[model samples]
Target: MSELIGRLIQPRQPAFWFMVVLNALSMVLAWLAQKPELTLTVSLLIAAFALGNAALGAFFAWQLIRRPAK
Candidate 1:
């Protein structure tokens, strides 16, 4: 629905998208290097970052939803 789309594409959401892109690029570079240990480490870090970003976005959405209407 349009409402769900609005919630996802809100102004503050760009930071999360940026983080995702950066992590994805790092993952690709790590993969290209062919180092198992480094790849694993980067993967774990990206997972953590993703979780954090999700939490942050959820918190922001909740705040936006709860704000009294103008």
Candidate 2:
């Protein structure tokens, strides 16, 4: 619904988007490396990074929502 979409698009701390960009760049570099081992390592690292970021973002949003209105 619109509520979910709004939450997703709402701006938050800058670190979230920075990590996303970093992960994307990492993926591109991995694809272009042309080495099987390096690509595999980078892919795994990027996946871990993405999952961690998601968890962090969820925690931050939950905290924000739970804060009492001032």
Candidate 3:
């Protein structure tokens, strides 16, 4: 788990960008799902996931940009 996170924090060119975009899109979808038939627990779960993904995306983006030019 530590290794996976360490890897995530390190840029991987196209793959890293793709992961960022994917997480962004997923977060958007989760945010959008907070409506209608879902119960409070379900909605909260979705929101939690959205927030988590958002944090992850921010972290990865920061790390990617923070990386020194190669």
Candidate 4:
């Protein structure tokens, strides 16, 4: 478990930072999804945030895939 955690953070680069943001955003989205009484405005905001993250995540993913293997 510790090995996995260490490997996850060892890079200290843009991908790592984006990963951290993505994780936090996912948790927030999950928690929000479980709520039954959210206002429409709040829901819309979350949806927008998610969409923005999706674009950013896709760009980074493309960059990662394009990177030459070690």
Candidate 5:
């Protein structure tokens, strides 16, 4: 049971875990900004932020998944 718990909480890499946190925060920010009445400029800015977050998350995840040389 302890082993299982540890595995669940432990991240494979520290950088990946940090990215996960950042991604979560970005998602929350995007959610908060999701408003139909917002002006085009604000909406565009929010969209850009969201896209940048997603791209960074993807890149970090990719780097984590790719095995490095021995």
Candidate 6:
């Protein structure tokens, strides 16, 4: 486990913008799935995932923007 951890490195490119766009899209899809014909359980699950992804995206974006690029 220590060896594996030591080998891991943060990517130089933050890719925060990409994540933000993807998560935003996911949230939109999840919202759309809440139509009358959709299953309530499935819609809720999707919404939850969407919310999580969006939060992660926002966090990454904030971190990326906070630092000055080398």
Model 2, position 10: C-alpha lDDT score = 36
lDDT of each: 0.55, 0.54, 0.68, 0.63, 0.68, 0.64
State each candidate's clash count. Answer: 0, 0, 0, 0, 0, 0
Number of the candidate with higher TM-score, 5 or 6? 5
Q: Determine the C-alpha RMSD for candidate 6 after optimal superposition of all C-alphas.
A: 9.5
Off by over 4 Å in 4: 1-13, 30-34
Residues forming the 10-long window of minimal summed lDDT in candidate 6: 2-11
What range of 10 consecutive residues in model 1 has the weakest lDDT sum? 61-70
Q: What are the runs in model 6 whose C-alpha is more than 4 Å off?
A: 1-12
How does residue 67 of candidate 6 score in lDDT?
54
By TM-score, the better pick of 1 and 3 is: 3
1-70 in candidate 5: lDDT tens per residue? 6543343343766756866876886787588568888887887888788778878876766665553412
**Per-residue lDDT of candidate 6, residues 10-58 (tens digit):** 2565465566576777778777768778788877877777777777776
lDDT of 1 by residue, 1-70 (tens): 6565555454555544654565566555445445565566676676666556556656655654444322
Residues 10-37 of candidate 4: C-alpha lDDT, one tens digit per residue: 3545776785577578567756755669
lDDT of 2 at 6: 48
Q: Check candidate 5 and list the clashing pairs.
A: none
Worst 10 residues of 2 by lDDT: 61-70
lDDT of 1 at 5: 52
Could you tell me how far off, in angstroms, the CA of residue 30 lies in candidate 1 after the best superposition?
15
Tell how far residue 66 is off in model 1, in angstroms.
Answer: 0.8
lDDT of 2 by residue, 1-70 (tens): 6554444443464544554565565555545455565666776775666566556656655543444322
**lDDT score, candidate 6:** 0.64
